[model samples]
Target: MSVGTIVAVCVGNGGVPKHPVAEAKVGPDGLEGDRHRYHLHGGRDRALCLLSVDEVRSLEADGVRVAGPGAFGENLLIDGLDFSALRAGDRLLVRADDTPIELELFDVREPCATLRRIDRRFPDLMLGRSGFMARVLGEGTLRAELAIERP
Candidate 1:
């Protein structure tokens, strides 16, 4: 079985030092409501960000917060699993607490120069195909301890 983990989640318009707090929400056309959604390969108007679980683990160990560069806002940062395996329409069975919540992999979340700007090491970290985007099948608080184990 492929194992995955939830790195972190942020809600707000362009998660910066000061911004109105909000929850990560998904809607049609891949718009994250008032948030921006992007693709891992090359797409626009979607609120998605992808990073390997290994990278997330490293960040957590260092006690660092993965914030967007100035204005770009991302919701969830995941780690550990092979992102390329997740294709559009693939359903991710994420275990949320006692309940098994589902998120549909809707698109490929490619990287951008802004990502490099946010984390100077991002260019090295997300060297290959790093992450992708998905739509929430169920609404809930995507906490840090939560796991994205593939079933």
Candidate 2:
């Protein structure tokens, strides 16, 4: 099983660059209070957005300056698990409070125009390294620094 930890939990009202949070309630439609600017974003099959820590560092190395977690519009920034190599239907079990949140990878998260706000090259740079879009198979509360298992 692939193991990792959720280094950052992020949420936003309605746009790119989500802000980190201490904890968040995750449901079928993703983090409560998190808003997607477009309908193409949030749905049963595309509820949550996930990014890898290394991907952020890689972007930085390539000259794409990132503000922080959620800068790519990701809802969860995991430190070890890289979903890019995982296929659709792969699952990640987030060890939350009392219940674990199970998420299924479904698709690559598409970048929106808002990403240009970070940098003109930011949007294109995020192409394959952007992250994955996942749906909550099991819901629960998630906080920063929690363990995540890809099983």
Instruction: List the global CA lDDT of all models.
Output: 0.51, 0.85
lDDT of 2 at 12: 94
Write one digit per residue (lDDT tens) for candidate 2, span 1-151.
8899998889998787799998888899889879987888888898888889998898888888778888888898989885656887888898887888889999877777788888887578778788889999887888888999887
Number of the top-ranking candidate, with lDDT as the measure: 2
User: Which stretches of candidate 2 lie above 4 Å from their native place?
Assistant: none
* TM-score of candidate 1 on Cα atoms, chains taken together: 0.58
Stretches of candidate 1 off by over 4 Å are: 15-34, 37-48, 55-74, 119-127
lDDT of 1 by residue, 22-45 (tens): 333333233243433323322332
Worst 10 residues of 2 by lDDT: 80-89
TM-score of candidate 2 relative to the true fold: 0.94
